[model samples]
Target: MRSVLAACLLLGLAHTARAEAPLTLRFVAPERYTDAQSRTGSGPTLRTTIGGLERIFRDLAGRTLHPGQSLTVDVLDVDLAGTDLPGAGPTAPRLVTDVTPPRLRLRYALRERGRVVLAAEETVTDINFLLRARPGGSSSLAYERDILAAWFGARIARREPPRG
Candidate 1:
């Protein structure tokens, strides 16, 4: 009886020691951008944008993921130059962007048990951020990052059906 009780106790301890596996995140951005204003902005390098997005996604996943769930984001393209309007002077063609809004296109999949539970290709853009200003400079990237965080946060929180 004593040996049987000890075995039972050991099994219980082993089960208690086991921890749930963490959700996994995979980010893929094969394209590169050097001229985007965000690269010149105050956030981070455009080359490292994938890393930045991964960090943001991880933070959001912490609150949104359940065990056995995973996410993959494939950034197909990025255009941070926004829309360019007509400008003045000989350099008008170069300096003509008074109201530029960032644009991002990506495909994402949320999976569980080896099946895609939710997936979508999304494009996000906003010109309203142009009116806002950064603390020290005119880097549109900072505003774009904030916009991305909000957009992604809401999507992760809701886990809604795909919208084209």
Candidate 2:
């Protein structure tokens, strides 16, 4: 009976070991990554993008992660949707073409107890700007944010426990 009890306890401990905790999000990126060059048209800054990403992850965590899991994001690059004018100097008025979509690249790690369970570097883009035209106050930037959120959420879901 004692042996059976020990085995059961061990099993319980194992299950707990795999259980996740509430997600903690950390962002690392360039300060200039979030700057606005032109008022006519430009994508969000690195910070803004990160905020949106975190919001999405927070929602996903509430629905997916166990409780203590954490995500650390390191933003590498940001290419906003617009064209840089060749002759436009710093003193000249900024003019940007708003037809292009944005691109974001970053590296991230999903960890538990300081041990990384998953790590990846991804480049997210909105070439077609499919989400750009969505109504309800959704901008091209919002569309980009949603795309990143969905992609990241899917990846996290794969590692998360099944919802009961």
Candidate 3:
């Protein structure tokens, strides 16, 4: 009985160790990203922005992916939804206008059961972000998060064919 219990425990431990996160994220040359840093004094810092994005990606993958499916994302560039007005004070809000849309560029790979199923480099943008009816009302990084969610739904979650 003792030996059987030990074997069962070992198996459980091994299974737990083999479980993997649905999403893995990497940011390349974040300093060179177009608009990743905080522009306002009270805005989120660089680390905060990156952390928030990682959380969003992980959440999306967790909700949308199957048990054996995983996604890896390498973020190449980011241009936020709004532009900071020239000479605006540190406390001034980032101005959102029709022309200043949110943009994100990323390379991603989707895998299932240790096999690569899809991969692509994509540039995502929402030109009419401000005009669209968004469900989340003015949350932190709301515009950026919305665009990322849309991209995840259309590309990664859909399990589209790999692009050349």
Worst 10 residues of 3 by lDDT: 84-93
Instruction: Name the regions of candidate 3 deviating beyond 4 angstroms.
Output: 1-18, 39-42, 86-92, 161-164
Q: Model 2: clashing residue pairs?
A: 20-67, 21-67, 21-68, 21-69, 22-67, 22-68, 34-45, 34-46
Could you tell me how far off, in angstroms, the CA of residue 151 lies in candidate 3 after the best superposition? Answer: 1.0
Clashing pairs in 3: none
Can you tell me which runs of candidate 2 are displaced by over 4 Å? 1-29, 32-64, 81-99, 131-133, 159-164
For residue 77, model 2's alpha carbon misses the true position, in angstroms, by: 2.1
- Highest TM-score model number: 3
Number of the candidate with higher TM-score, 2 or 3: 3
Q: In angstroms, give how far residue 133 of model 1 lies from its true place.
A: 7.9
For residues 1-164, write the lDDT of model 1, one tens digit per residue. 99999999999888655433334544344445323323223433454555655565566666666776667776666665443233332222222143655666767777776688778888766667645545654433465566666666656556766455
Residue 87 lDDT, candidate 3, scale 0-100: 56
Error of 3 at 100 (Å): 1.2
Reference-based TM-score of each model: 0.54, 0.52, 0.79
Ranked by TM-score from best down, the candidates are 3, 1, 2
Worst 10 residues of 1 by lDDT: 87-96
For model 3 the local lDDT of residue 126 reads 80
User: For residues 1-164, what per-residue lDDT tens digits would candidate 3 score against the true structure?
Assistant: 99999999999998876676668789999999988776555445678778878887887777888998878899999887777665565445677788888888999888898798888888888887877637656665788878878787878778655344
